[model samples]
Target: MTSVSEGRIHGGAVPLITRGPLRTTLRAGDGVRIEAVYEPCTAGAAAADGAAGAGTAIVLAHGFTGSADRPAVRRAAEVFAQRAAVVTFSFRGHGGSGGRSTVGDREVLDLAAAVAWARSLGHRRIVTAGFSMGGSVVLRHGALYTAPGVREEGGGRTEAHGEAHADAVVSVSAPARWFYRGTAPMRRLHWMVTRPTGRLVGRYGFRTRIDRRPWDPVPLSPVEAAGRIAPAPLLIVHGDRDPYFPLDHPRTLAEAAGGAAELWLEPGMGHAENAADESLLTRISDWATAR
Candidate 1:
């Protein structure tokens, strides 16, 4: 992985390697092709290795305009795989995946597909970690699919029957409320440039483009979906100095969760700035695996 500014790691250059010799692939409802790097954990292996109880599985999703090959995704994948099974895939219109971006409205379906795929592989316990837009996708998925559903072509069945399908959700730098007026100054500037730019790009048939559709024109907003995820174990991580969605976004989400959620505010951290914080990541992983 190449090192970028703000200690961010970019995994686009590196190829994904799975534990076993074989690999897995899935197709979304929209015919978007998706790939997953899987690591199998047999009952015997779990018995031999005391750390494999319950067959914990983690699905990592990248942010807007990012693919599964991003550094943050790779890092989280490696960390979670050591403890349990790990599957990371690209969102539609990004990386090797297909289809246009839906600003996370439809991407939640993609995440649900990923979770089902992991469960099909015999993962009894599942957790999803998403960064930026990916974070929003996981939250939306938790809100939308409160009950178990039939697995997609290559996906697995939902783990729970009702209100128990998703065990836990972790969102990093996710904007809880999309169209709030209390945005920070830098974010306001971004909106100023992105809104007009999105409309202009839409005129040229680039509206569904990953970058333009989500940020520029404000695609699917997550704030409206926050209330739907209450009573679920939600983790909202944000930097106190975040210039993107503003720290208030997470704070509001935590309050909305009504004591069912936890918020971790990194002092002086900026947007996606905690990519290199291994301790924080481990803490989140532990929370995901804990009963």
Candidate 2:
């Protein structure tokens, strides 16, 4: 789980200068209630873009152990709000939402629900951008549900499934596969997600309850799913110095995506949303808007 206050603060002027995030909830694939908020783009952005970006929206998925209010998450949202509408949500179990964390598997449903809400609000061009685990979820979500009239996962997993889409996707510091513990940070994370005592610590110490169940059949790896995001451009961003995944994760995903994806291995970056640079975030915002 991500620490709540470790990074720079954002949304300081949220209620005063900018409109507060409109609150809402949507049931995920397994019917777990997911907490979510949609922040309208800063006033006059539609006019400034000559309304080209009017139908566009950006959905942000925070990292493991993170909630919508985490400073880094909020900062990214605030920065994006200056460009277009922003939707940020705590994947089930991470914040004011029901259910336990499935790490990155069931979180795909949470991202789906958020994307559905964005589309329901009439945003025709939606981009799903996530950090770390959330980044992996966005990739899977985009791959699984990019087109309508296609069969996707359903039954008990979520009430409403499929049809949600990410016209463009930006995955920041996400791993290519599961059970990665090569780095010290990831080793600690594996401990937190796999052990009972570690889960207790997660529940009390980090406010995250990682599910103990192993992935049933194992969900599609991010590298595998990257192939499906073609036609719809994919951006794989990783820090060259990322403690959790190093450079290979992004390389694998980019190779899977082939020419349909672009990769940016940041020079001095670390891991996930919290460690992402502001310039990188702005570049993501620009990418989403252009798509």
Candidate 3:
């Protein structure tokens, strides 16, 4: 069950705002505590300004090492809030959330909790937008939650029935497959995830706690998940210059969807939330609303 509490917005990276966002602690189905924030829509096109999206809500899943309070995550929330209410949360092991990071393996439960909360708040439409590691998560979450009879790898039934299903999904700068060491950035990330000393760096330098255990049964790949998110709108956005995953990642995802998804190959954009400019964000917001 998820509980609400008044949360203050602070930290040097966060910009001063006239209104404070609603903060709460979300308990995932597995009982991990997730830190989340809800920002009301400020756009003029909506029926009521600051009415919490009126009818729509966008849930944001940040990349590895990112938190709801990060400047980049807040910036994306601010932009999306122009079109709909926004939900942003820190994955387990990041920010003030509990539990160690399972990388992308068990993070699906965190996203599910956030989406269910958004639905409970009376939003008719819920869209999920994820970046980097988060990008892969949203895809898998959409597949596991929206599709019936889809199970986890080890004969475990995914809790597919719930309000956790997203009406639409957006993935930015996510990898197609796991254990990709082709790029230098990806190699460094693997080191941070696999090595003991590297986990220390993740904890101290990045404020992210890495889980030391390996996946007992690997989860679905992003490409495979994309194929199952049909009948629901899916948007895959990737940068040509993304140092993490190349253009091929988005391409494979688009192809896997069997023409059911939209693919955008951005020019000169780097990676994740930090690289998402206002113009691009505005376009993404427009796309979500138009669907």
Candidate 4:
């Protein structure tokens, strides 16, 4: 972890070592590396005692421009750890992971690798949760990879059991459509910084000097991928007062998921606000354990 004078911490060499369960690094097909953190389900343990009977695990992903150490990510991990194993890692170039950030385009592959790592650890029941851009990755995972339970444990016949899929998914303050239609404030910010400064930061690291492309392409849109997660439980939580994404983003996702998914609208809450809310944390814990 290298610190910059401007207070921005870049995570590349500093690795997060976890001993609670198991820790590993996954190398994606695209040559990007992802760190995987896991906590096991133990009987009578402080967190998983309540969820010990479920035998489930959670694979968590952080939002855009944020790492696994973000406050929200840590809080959610602690909450979920009470009942089940919690796994989180940095997407490419964001935290201790390698490679440059491609927005959410290639990040999806990092997420897939994380999920695969979780499955290898004997997590038959898996639930994936992501924040903002990370949420978009969860939705994309549902579309690209069949949920964990889609196949039988040993060699039995594949069943259409809803439990076979990700029992539950949570997305916080995610944007349904950012590349095409973003909020006014977000558009203004993009116009102000994306042209020159954003390009410079992306090209020559955060503090270096260089010129790069104006806009990074969006390969996957939440609105387009929402419908693909059908038959699996999905939850979209967004702030009504979010300045970057329109309030309708969550609603659009809910509608796209048909009745299988639901949306929670947080009044007066900005983006990522619910992450610090005690009540919201409890709700997330309860929801994840219900499966």
Candidate with best lDDT: 3
TM-score for each of the candidates? 0.73, 0.87, 0.88, 0.76
Worst 10 residues of 2 by lDDT: 3-12
How displaced is residue 94 in candidate 2, in Å? Answer: 0.5
| Model 2 TM-score, all chains together | 0.87
lDDT of 4 by residue, 220-284 (tens): 57776687676667888888778778777898888888767878898877876334476775576
Supply the TM-score for candidate 4: 0.76
Ten-residue region with minimum lDDT total, candidate 1: 1-10
* Candidate 2, 132-231: lDDT as tens digits: 9988888887777645554444512222433376788999999998888888989998888888988998999999877888777678778878887767
Could you tell me how far off, in angstroms, the CA of residue 30 lies in candidate 1 after the best superposition? 2.8
Q: What is the lDDT of residue 120 in candidate 2?
A: 73
RMSD to true structure for each model, in Å: 9.2, 7.0, 6.8, 8.3
Every candidate's lDDT? 0.62, 0.78, 0.83, 0.63
Minimal lDDT window, size 10, model 4: 1-10
lDDT of 1 by residue, 1-291 (tens): 111101111112223223462345666544456665665433335633556434677788787666666676777766665556677887766666766565566676567667766665556667878887788887776665554453333444333223224667888888786544465743543453357665344334432344344443344356655666655578888887776777778888777777677889888666652353677677777777774
Sort the candidates on lDDT, descending order: 3, 2, 4, 1
Better of 1 and 3 by TM-score: 3
What tens digits encode model 3's per-residue C-alpha lDDT throughout 125-165?
Answer: 88999999999999998877763444534453334335678
User: Where does candidate 3 have its weakest 10-residue lDDT segment?
Assistant: 3-12
